[model samples]
Target: MVDENAGAIITVFVLGVVTVLHLLGAVPARLVLIFGLFAVVLLLAIGLLVLGEIRDGMRDAR
Candidate 1:
């Protein structure tokens, strides 16, 4: 649980920095959105799978 939270924290921190930079006009909006999507979809998904919180073929069963 702690390991998963650490990974999540790192992901969130990276995304937050990107969002802040975008708001400050240093990063493009499109890039920010792409970063957000990648972090949410790919990063989190794979991380959870690796951590065994999400098992195979159980994503939409709820």
Candidate 2:
């Protein structure tokens, strides 16, 4: 079973790192925002896919 909190922790870490990099001028703000948006969409898609798989597994377990 996946630990649900792990995902939230990883998501927060990634965002924090990106924000720090942007503030440090390591990356352009516009580029960071675009990449962040893309990352969020990708994460959401993966989460939905995982949820579907879990739901199917539960249904089959019965």
Candidate 3:
């Protein structure tokens, strides 16, 4: 669970930073939305992959 949630935690942190930067007028809303979606999908994929590997490793060990 920790391994799986790690990606989500990072994604949320990154999105928060991006939102702040956008609010500060450092980035456009369109760019932020697009980039945010990409980041979310990528992060989720990575998280799932890591989780799968961890599960597999544990199962193999057992």
List candidate 1 stretches off by more than 4 Å. Answer: 42-62
Runs with alpha carbons beyond 4 Å of true place in candidate 3: 1-17
Each model's RMSD to truth, in Å? 6.1, 3.5, 3.8
TM-score, prediction 3: 0.58
* Candidate 3: residue 23 lDDT (0-100): 95
For candidate 3, write residues 9-58 as lDDT tens digits: 78778888889999999988997898689777978787778889889999
- Looking at model 2, how many pairs of residues clash? 0
Per-candidate total of colliding backbone pairs = 0, 0, 0
The lDDT for every candidate, in the order shown, is: 0.77, 0.76, 0.82
Model 2 poorest ten-residue lDDT run: 1-10
TM-score (all chains, Cα) for each model: 0.59, 0.62, 0.58
Cα lDDT tens digits for candidate 1, 1-62: 56656777787788999999988999989988887887788566666667675454467575
Task: Report the candidate with higher lDDT, 1 versus 3.
Answer: 3
Top model by lDDT, which number?
Answer: 3
Query: 61 in model 3: Cα distance from truth in Å?
Result: 1.3
- TM-score, ranked from best to worst: 2, 1, 3
